[model samples]
Target: MTKEITIDDLKMYRALVETGSVLGKNTVLNIISHAGEAAETILRKQNAIDTLDRIITQQCQAALDATGLHHLIDEDGDGDWSAVWEGLQELADQKRHAERNADTYQKLYEQRAESLEQAERERDEWRGKYDESETARIFGEAQQERVRALHSPEPARYYGTDLNPNRQHDCAGCGEGWAWPCGTIRALDGDPNAAV
Candidate 1:
């Protein structure tokens, strides 16, 4: 029967049988060969994996046969988690908006700690350059440089017509986060339509 069925019909049938969705019409007809019990196991496992977290996915993949959850966890009916698209999009938007406009106290704390480390190093440099008393006096004379250098503004920055301050740097806000943007870390995201 499949031999007579067109590729489009096959893909549609696959999508319907595999995910019960009409998505990924592009690959609907690519599963004429999978129109059997073997396809059921593969599609079932694929759904299971898609619904799982990374640790669970790995553990399940390790223990469960490939025909099981492999298709689900990393499946993309049309190359995406068509089943959880809305949930995923909502999470992304939440993170993005939260990162940009919410209480970034946690992120700012990290930046502060980093700045403190830099400041400590700079203070050490000053101490090496001069006696502790002299270093203290110099820093007390102008705390702005010490503050900027330690807190951030390390790589480089130009606040005003102030030609340059020996060690200015790009601002943290330049890269999204005032210190560490979320992309600094990437959470796992799987797509089934990707190449093997």
Candidate 2:
């Protein structure tokens, strides 16, 4: 195909035409040679660009064919890049949702662990109080038993003749002779009116 002249090429041509009559023959020839060289460079650059574009297109098409992703291309052979962009956005959204759920579960786990620890501490405190009360109860019973043993009654003794006998019972701890039920024994048996 024939190449169209650009504005820059037209301007160069106009400058050459205007200077051709005043310039020497060698100068005119040199100007034309330089113009030709500039045009050749532009053509070479355009050819290289075209070759690179073709190579890239061929490689992209080959990759799509191998991956079986030809549906991502439109009927005009252009890639539907918006579809890929939307898919990436969806994945990012899912990742954000998963991270939020993980944070919620982690908070719940920490709260549960803290609650369990609190319950265990309370249980230990209650157990300690129960042990103290039980020990007090056992010590109180032992002291009560010791008091009962000290104040126990013995057999009655008579210190007179058979006609007029004075009978009295002896205390086991103090060996004192008194009435049948002693004051100390009555007090140990929880009598409120017992005298000591």
lDDT of each: 0.53, 0.75
Give the top-scoring candidate (lDDT).
2
Q: Write the per-residue lDDT of candidate 1 for residues 39-114, one digit (tens) a residue.
A: 6798999987887767665644443342233344444322223434444556678789887865687778889999
Q: What TM-score goes with each of the models?
A: 0.17, 0.44
Clashing pairs in 2: none
For model 2, the stretches where C-alpha displacement exceeds 4 angstroms are: 1-92, 159-170, 174-176, 179-181
TM-score of model 2 vs. true structure: 0.44
lDDT of 2 by residue, 1-196 (tens): 2887676875676676677745665666576678679999999999999999999877767655555567898777788755545655666788899999999999999999999999999999999999999999999989988877767567666546573266546666757566556776777778888884
